[model samples]
Target: HKGQELVMADIPGLIAGAAEGVGIGDRFLGHIERCRVLLHLVDASLPGPVEQWRVVREELAAYGGGLENKPEILALSKVDLVTPQALAAKKRALEKASGQHIYTVSAATKQGVEPVLDKLMEIAGRAQAMKVESDKSWSPI
Candidate 1:
């Protein structure tokens, strides 16, 4: 718990046709263009969580505003509703599908939430450090 602060914004839900100006459209994609990382919260309790993840990824790629290239953390929400076996299965499936670590969290119980936040902060800190380094002009004083 260092003295680092991470800011997160809540954007509108993206639909299947969001890239085509459907269901809130891709207008909000620009809002996160500069963001160093993205937390993609997926409902694990529902069916086809992997498919849902792909749909969002597709929309981001279609929008084409650097969103598709941003680092993303896949978070599986509502794990409490599913059994341990089911949760593990979904997590593995999602991990294989996205090729990224899958964080399981239950907002209702606050389970596995802190680790996600900590990971995000760690990523943001690194990104900030890189930005600072790149922003500096080498001065041989």
Candidate 2:
């Protein structure tokens, strides 16, 4: 590596019915539970974006560890594969469907990647600050 201070782990994606002992369920998803941030990358060109997102959520919730509340950055990956108009429409539908911050990016081309990374950094920084504040509040004065 580049002498990076932080470690990045790449875990296998949790599939449908993962919580019920489906394919590679227990083997990979437990790692996700320990993560502080979840970068959810959904393929937006799919026929039903909302339903797909919900199914993923359900799988995570069933797996437990309060992942449902963890801060998530939704990115409709593979935008380069779709037309701009189509992407925009899907993004809107996904936003209305998830009620969360959404970003569109094509990982292959590096389009729209910086903004998402910046936002994620900002979110992580805030969470760290809040944790410090919470810990301080609990200390005996």
Candidate 3:
């Protein structure tokens, strides 16, 4: 077994019409509401990173029910396939696209994992800090 005590499921990739019971959409999206954060792993080498990003964004937004509000860290996976210069460029593009710090990682090579993990931990810390800062309802956004 993996060392982690908790399990996270990778649901079927959300498709168009998922919210309307098209192709296991409801069942797949049901779990997203419970998550505190979402690591949006996108393939950076795709033809149009921004366009692909919007497709996913549109799918989630159309899903409705506040799912769109979930805090997310945008990440581009499979960096090892590209040259270093290309990787940096892709990272910049994704960061600009998502309006968040973008991480380029290759899970296979273990490159860039630590920084990505650090960002996730940093976000968690900020969430805790927010709780301690004010009892009144204040959104992180």
On TM-score, the leading prediction is 1
> What does the lDDT read for residue 16 in candidate 1?
90
lDDT of 3 by residue, 54-92 (tens): 766777788886778877778788877777787777777
Q: Candidate 3: which pairs clash?
A: none
lDDT of each: 0.88, 0.79, 0.72
Segments of candidate 2 deviating more than 4 angstroms: 1-7, 133-141
Point out where model 3 deviates above 4 Å.
1-7, 125-141
Model 3 clashing-pair count: 0
lDDT of candidate model 1 versus the reference = 0.88
Q: Which of candidates 1 and 3 reaches a greater lDDT?
A: 1
Which candidate's lDDT is highest? 1
lDDT of 1 by residue, 14-79 (tens): 889888888775777778787899999999999999998999999999989778888888899999
Worst 10 residues of 3 by lDDT: 1-10
TM-score (C-alpha) between model 1 and the true structure: 0.91
